[model samples]
Target: MPRFAANLSMLYTELDFLDRFAAAARDGFQAVEFLFPYAFAPEELAARLHENQLQQVLFNAPPGDWDAGERGLACLPGREVEFRAGIHQALAFAQALTCSRIHVMAGVVPSNQRPEDCHSTYLENLRYAAAAAAWQGVQIMIEPINERDMPGYFLNRQAQAHALLDEIGSPHVMVQMDLYHLQVSEGDLASKIRRYLAGGRIGHIQVAGVPERHEPDVGELNYRYLFQLLDQLGYPAWIGCEYRPARGQRPHATSEGLGWLQAWL
Candidate 1:
């Protein structure tokens, strides 16, 4: 069976961020993930996870200046220093939380910059991050977000992410495959999963409803079948529930919308 992790960043929006951990555990989720942990102290986040007996499966390295429309710094030419600093900070949190994976977002490509330059910078930065994380026994994850959702995002396809991993040539670095992005950008998801998962480069997996980004069962992709496929392929990793509740942010909306997960469980 595929282990599922609640993405606290998206789910449980009605509760405080710290309170979401207990809510997830109460809902029977054994693990959790989120976008960024930089807003809170590592000790505080760690305490919640310990209290809930929840494993912190994944989280992102800081995306530079989120308020200024900056999504990530990995692919930006002049932000290598900031990107590396963010990696160090992420690893520190990973250690405190006993988390083993960190997602590094490839920022939006600047209109004035060359794609080739961005590609080179992305490779260099990932290699550096992988090296830094390896010492901490943590792996660095690179996700290919869809351009529709994040226009001009540097990475946008599974093959593209795997090829970059090839160039980076570090076992500590791998792709963070999100099915929602895969369905939007490229629809041959089963083939992509088999191809990449078989190749041993997919470090983590995430799921959300297609088109609307709601609970997985609300999507057209048929996650029940995909969940079975994952088991058939022996994918032994956590699948992060990275989606919003279709129930909106009303009280208990996240829990009420967990029929999909409960059915599988």
Candidate 2:
């Protein structure tokens, strides 16, 4: 069975941030992940994870000023100090929660800065993050968000993500394959997964419907088959459910819409 992890940031809108852990457990999710868990103290989050008997699968290393529209800081030039500091903080939380992976979001490339310049900065930061995380037995992940969803975001394609991971050349560093973004940026979903898996760089995976970004059952992608493929491929990691739980369908609706999850598990 595919190990499904509820994305608390996208789902579970009924309660406060801290309360989502219990909600996920009640809904029968084995694990949970979120955009950023840096808001609460690491100790508090750990307590909730333990109390709910839920595993903390994944979370992004602080995306700089999310409300300010900053997606991530790893690629932004002159932010090396801050990026390194964020990695340290993320690692601390991962250790506290006994989580194994943390995503390093690559922020946008400014108009004045060349893409090459920004790319170099990104690789530099990842090199540092990979070294730091390897020490703690925590893996570092880079996700390729779709251009439509996050315009000018430093990383936007699976191939690009794979190239960067290859350059980093660390077993602890891998790509976060989000199928929703993959459909938007590059098609050939199954082949891409197989290719990345062949390279042994797929650290994590996520799924949602292609255009609408809803529950996997409603979208163009055949998540049922994909889930089975992961199982067949011996993918032994959490597949994050990183989709919006349908607008206006808050609180209990989140659990109501978990039929797909129920079927997959």
Candidate 3:
């Protein structure tokens, strides 16, 4: 069976960020992921994971100033210095937590910038990140968020993600494929998995129900079949459960609402 990791950032909204670790474990999740971990001390977060026996499967590098609307700094033209610093900070946390993957978000393209210009900068920054991460034995992941959820985001399609990977030519850089985004932007999930996973391009995977982005069981896609497909292809990475609990099912009712994962387990 494919292993599943709870996305604490999106899943356990009812609890505080630090408390989500234990909540995930109590819900029968063995591993977990999140958007960012910079606010807390790496050692403190490590202690939580050790105490709960949970693995930190993945987390994103610090996206530049989220409230100011900076989704990521990697694609921004003049933030190369800030971007590199963020990578080091992420590595420090990953090392303390024993996490092996970090997804580097591509920032939204500014209205004044040309797509080609931004993409060129993105390639260079990813090249730097890949080399730095490879030295520390951590893989760099690039996720393509759908335009609907993150309009103007530089990376938004699987084909574009793979093509960029080919150009980067870094063995350590891989695709952080989010199924929800793929379904939104490009609907042929089965065909995409067959081509990408079979070829070993996918480094990590995240899933949620379509339209509502809730529990996978209620989604338009047959996630149960996809889970089987992961095993058939011998894809061994963790499948991050990056979704919200269905309405009225978060916080106090989390564990009971985990029926979908219970079925898989």
User: TM-score, each model?
Assistant: 0.99, 0.97, 0.97
lDDT of predicted model 1? 0.94
Model 3 residue 205 lDDT score: 95
- Candidate 3 per-residue lDDT, tens place, 1-30, comes to 889999988877887889989988987889
Q: Which candidate is the best by lDDT?
A: 1
What is the C-alpha local distance difference test score of each model? 0.94, 0.88, 0.90
lDDT of 1 by residue, 115-173 (tens): 99999999999999999999999999999999999999999998888888889999999
lDDT, candidate 2, at 179: 91
Q: List the residue pairs that clash in candidate 2.
A: none
RMSD of each: 0.7, 1.2, 1.1
Sorting all predicted structures by TM-score, with the top scorer first, yields 1, 3, 2
- Please state the error at residue 260 of candidate 1 in Å: 0.8
lDDT at 249, model 2: 51
Lowest lDDT block of 10, candidate 2: 244-253
Candidate 2 segments whose C-alpha is farther than 4 A from its true place = 247-249
Please write out the lDDT profile of model 2 over residues 29-102, one tens digit for every residue.
87999988777899999999999999988999988888889889988999889999999999999999999999
Top candidate when judged by TM-score against the true structure = 1
